[model samples]
Target: MSETILEELFIKRSQQKRKASPLNYKERWFVLTQDKLSYYDYDLNKAKRKSLRGFVELEKIKCVETVQPEPNSPPERSYAFQVIYDEGPLYVFAKNDATRGEWIKKLKEKVRFNKDLIQKYHPCFWADGMWQCCQQQVKEAVGCKVLEHKNGVGFSSKNSSRRRPSRKPLPPTPEEEKPGCRPLPPQPPEEPSHSVGMTVIAEYGYTPVTPQDLELRKDEEYTILEMTDANWWKARDNTGREGYIPSNYVVNAGNGLERFDWYCKNMNRSQAENLLRTENKDGGFLVRDSSKAGKYTVSVFTKGGGESSGNSRHYNICTTQQGQFYLAEKHYFNSIPDLINYHQHNAAGMVSRLKYMVSNRAQPPSTAGLGYGIWEIDPLHLKTIRELGNGQFGVVKYGTWMGQHDVAIKMIKEGSMSEDDFIEEAKIMMKLRHENLVQLYGVCTKQRPIYIVTEFLCNGCLLTYLREGQTQHPTTIQLLEMCKDVTEGMAYLESQQYIHRDLAARNCLVDANGTVKVTDFGLSRYVLDDEYTSSAGSKFPIRWSPPEVLLFCRFSSKSDVWAYGVLMWEVYTMGSLPYQRLNNTEIADQVPRGLRLYRPQLANERIYSIMNRCWHDKPDERPTFQELVVIVQDLLYELQ
Candidate 1:
């Protein structure tokens, strides 16, 4: 009973001029004031004041009830209710049964308070300061109309006590005996002349105020009535109801089933990014057209877990103006296949890759039967020599497996990953075999401390080896040979569509024989497509990343080629760091503006040309790993 009303809303009401006129449901804005219930036509410009259509003083209302279709009512007016008053019943039809019930509930609450104010209230309609319902039309009239009715009833309390007989008993409650509530008749056929032959392409629900709007359920046909804009359309549903819906929600049915590429065209960059982030949260990606013509944007989403907890990041796979695809904007690739190949060797910077393997939940083909040279070593026979290094997934220790084989045992920390996740990673590792790639012996899954056993390189990581061996001063021929070893391993991986995301010299291991082998599958993912985007904010080796990787978090094999250029610089300089004078932040800022590492003093012109090709701004401009292997071999031959 507060004086102020609660809320106002827009609704459609069936208005009729006479008893025989057809019911026309028009949109109106309804407002409940302190003393009355009123409605007005909604103006197209909301800033303008509303013109009142009609109103009823609260004092005149007696009760309200959900009404059945009457003999005189239109067939489509089945969903309706009536407001009982002393003057007459005001009938209102809603779009649906649920709406009818809501109106009845609100009207019932107002009627209870109306009885108290009836004695002092008079029913009057005002327009131009006169009672429009009772006044005669006159030129230049500006005052109140005649106050008395033709029957001699004046607008005063002298005859206010007079009461009329009740029309009928109030409608029964749900528990009472029911009668005469027949089902409504079927609706008339829809008009066919307005058909424009469009159909709903995706499911969409109606959310606006008007009931004339139709819900665009999936596969439903809707003919276009008008094109509101590039994004919206006024369309008519099969039931003949017309309203505005997003244009993208409907399309030409004759186009047949849509392709994955079609669904992503013309989408906003942020919207596509959000879709990949939400839909592929566990680990997935999206491919869509880019802002650049004839190029596409690939989004790779990775969920962070284990040692890199809360390190989720998103990596975009896109081509620059020069047409090179990249991952995390660091690694560049000649093709999407080259980028995906790199991901197969690196999984550190993003979420799991289980989803990217296939469209279903089935695990990747088991490696149990594959002859990948996986050897099962007994944990008791393995002696822990010492800790080598720590990783996101586990800790690496130099150990002897089976009391004889020199091996690096990567013991996965407890709770770092689920048993299934570890098994999946191990299976992917077992399938890969190459001379320059580290060979996996096997995994220990039954014990508390799970171990991934692999061959041990006596000289340790290439970066550490280079730094420690600086005094030895390896010749140009020897450095080029090392570069060839890495390029060969990467070429093999590229052939398998495996991307080595963390492909710096640090991740490469050198054996006692001066051979460099690609190691560390911690940041690798097996991608079916050419690109894999990392989740947003995932940590990456910024120093090794290229301009695109640093700026946009894109990764690809061409990006690895960019890193290879840095690694080649590392070799000729005898382990000097790329961008030695600048920190990571400064390097990230300077690399995109054409700043590159200075040529190494010992690197001859031919060798420097090979490294320079790998640093091309456009990924496609970079030589493939296979081409680099050929170039490096020829350079080494010339020295020999």
Candidate 2:
């Protein structure tokens, strides 16, 4: 509602336009604003809008582009544009090419600040519930083409989504958060004559697996004319020759560094040091992006025999003018991963061998929305595997998305909470992505029962992990590292000016690799917000909340910090219930009276002091999450 950028009468297609053969299209008054794009049904006789049709938040938009005309298309709808948002696309047509160009330009400017902008999109029109170009039946499937920002160039194909045949229920494996490998596709058509093909660079060389398969040459650029399946793709080489190639052999030209377990895309020297030292491994190593433009650094941990231990060394992955990469002279390789792979086996010059490959990649954060811009997931793709836990909202279950991806589906009981408001609030929460936070994948709103899909952790809640986990005698360094993980995630929330409100061991989850992540964020819509009276009917986590939240119902980062202190107490006491034997009334009465949790026997002077600071009488007196991260990190370093 900031300012109206442009307004015009657009020939828009109905949401179910793809369901019919001829396609239903209509004329509507479209208004473009800084925050949203809205379309209205006009009263022709009155010369004004009769009713509001629909609107899309610009921030939720992933891609905006012109759609290529389908073969045997109508002339009036020839000049068309598409606005792709969470889960679906909005197709709008302009009268001429100039009008479409102007609207597209203004939209691009407004959405340039979006955090989840897509790099690819489908160019051709959709019909019969499928993409005409790619033949992908799923409306939310990823585009088969690449995107050029300025013109929004995209591609197409013969048939889309060569997915595997529906199989039996997959055994619930304990391999936490593991993404299953995908199968090759069915078929891909071709791109429109005016559109540019999706381009990629070959990362590995490959011999033809079949007579139909093309040989792949490393470091060569190829235009993807068609992506037939998940494995084989039809591509055109430099000489304008086309053939089939293995999809794994090539990567999005500049996105090769994205597919490694040892690579940390956004880690600095200090974070690298902290992670390596906290891991306390004799040969832990990780590759991180360098502060210098276009460079990378390798951080390794090694323990010197007997005399000294717990030492870390860092080296830059240097590159030569000829494009060869090397960690040391005369040991050049084709890529950075290759360089690290060599060092993982041989030290050659520096510290101990790059032994154990380390990274937080085991729990890579989920994208803002699922596949492409899909925020609202299709209920048809969700299958309830089993119940994990029961909560205030409803039961959370282990589930599969599209029979491939593992997801935690939280089924919201009908009429228990305000549905419309929760949906809108969820749209914002889905934007947050941090390694220490549980990710919200998407939501299912089309059916009678709504489901909230989120990232699934293997080991369940932290409270259970602390009590039920086999390792009863966790070392001081190990406890401090756990505290550090929760703090790092909280620190990110603090920086975003968002508050967790409810931070506790029960709310934190542990992954298979022993990493703890914060969950249940941004659920304040129907949750226990300031308006909650905490009567007998309402059940909430009062023990972990601060005095400010307990007495006045005021929530902020400081309140969350106070809860962190209590959560730490829970951790040290090995998951003992907070304020044991004391009721909620006693906690509400005693917490504001300056009664704080006592230090655990395991917590030494230094660790207790940090916890005490978080329980300061005044909210402002408590340390900020950023400051807490530093203090906890220092304690970790000392213990290590």
Candidate 3:
């Protein structure tokens, strides 16, 4: 490392560790060099009288990036940057953006060739034991958002992001039953390209779905051949290979709607409505996901005749066969935001013109875990927001994981289950991702009493939905969709070789959209794989149990199928208890002797027949979950 004739900003000098750090505003002279960064304290009276303070080897630097300033930070210190290395982050204050940029650009050049660069990084400052950006409590949690690098190496080992090899992503093909099943929706028109040939860069890497589909490489540019569908488009890569590509996966060279204002990627219909209504600006509007997947809805709120909040009108942003998006039938645009922009000026056919974007301050939903590889939650980070409820699980509370992510914490009174064993089992559970499963984030076993953390669904229990609220007067299609949600989750669990053991309406949760996800999946196994002991008694759910489960205690997918029948019975009867009139003692004795619940009034002959199949006396005779999904889907399609 040459030390002669180098700019002071080029080198940072000392590695001797010290405790009780000085304030960030303390100015120190940094010596910048090609391979070394050394900083020292110089006497104000004598320029040559300097003491070596601290330094970092540029080769060991992991990331060189700027951070969001804290509240009420001084202007000079506001241009701060962090130089992260094996030791941790080194915070340094710069005079302004120009100086900070210069230092960062030079530092990045020195460490560009360094191995193991992080892809995800927190943009906000880490303070008071929490990340100011995502509120993730873990100091070392993975970045809440993806950090892009021009050079392809963006994975974070600390955050557990791994560079993945290219693999084919088959285009979604919704299955259909034989002869009677509804035909698949018509594919978008293939002829006459919707948009004039335009170029786009892939934001995320993707493999070709079909031979006619082009591969999408991150940051790679391609020319549009045609717009086949809103979701899928035809494009030609640089090599002139023309094929279909997922539209949302690629963006115009400018990096698309990721940072685009007014587009809330994860905001559902209700949340958008609530935000728009709350703002109450006459033309207040926002874009969010539609109830139907892979579509968007424009929610606009307007006040009428002295109304305080006003009514919110939701319009499904429709797509034509040519792939043009439109709010009004005659007017169309190549992109959703383009439509939004146009509508902002002209109402055309809508009740109100698009205006305010309430999402300017809207926070994205927190990731399930504090960060990758963070299972053991530090007790300090967890805080009780409110008591959700107390019942079978014992004192379930609505709490914040790391004082950020909303989590339902189940406080258990008694359990001899070892933390080591549960931790091992939890690894698999955490990786089980399904839209229908109420995801188990992690367990708090650091202290005496164990706490279980799970994803919080806004609309409480499924039983409540069936009895009152939205599902109270659900139509045939609505009821079937809810049933389909449960079956899809159970089918996935069955495919994973995992059994819910206790499958009931009570054990399932409903989201704001009425989508039901199976909860407490594969969790009872920690207590004992085959044996589950709840706070009350043995966890062999009696009313739900088939003869084999009630008689032999033999739990399997088949037994779960039997429970599904009762769950279906509950759904059809609107959360009516099984054996409506009979007591448990009488029903238990009589059920084994071939007694069965009658069909619900909501269930017609066809639906009732399907429920009966699930209640077959022989376990093997019951329909597998996969079969049930198809049957229910087909029935729902017919109803729709």
Q: Name the candidate that leads on TM-score.
A: 2
- What are the per-residue Cα lDDT tens digits for candidate 1 across 416-439? 555555465565555456658887
lDDT (Cα) of model 3: 0.67
lDDT, each prediction: 0.56, 0.72, 0.67
lDDT (Cα, tens digit) per residue for candidate 2, span 318-386: 655346788878999988877877887888786877888787644334444454335799888888889
For all predicted structures, in order, the TM-scores are: 0.40, 0.51, 0.49
Give the residue spans of candidate 3 off by over 4 A.
1-291, 296-318, 355-363, 380-395, 398-406, 415-420, 434-436, 456-460, 464-497, 509-517, 529-539, 546-574, 584-640
Off by over 4 Å in 1: 1-378, 391-394, 414-419, 522-538
lDDT of 1: 0.56
Q: Among these predicted structures, which one has the highest lDDT?
A: 2
Expressed as tens digits, the lDDT of each residue in 456-521 for candidate 3 is 888888888778856446666666767778887898787665777778898899875456889976
- Clash count list over all predictions: 47, 13, 18
Instruction: Return the lDDT, model 1, position 94.
Output: 68
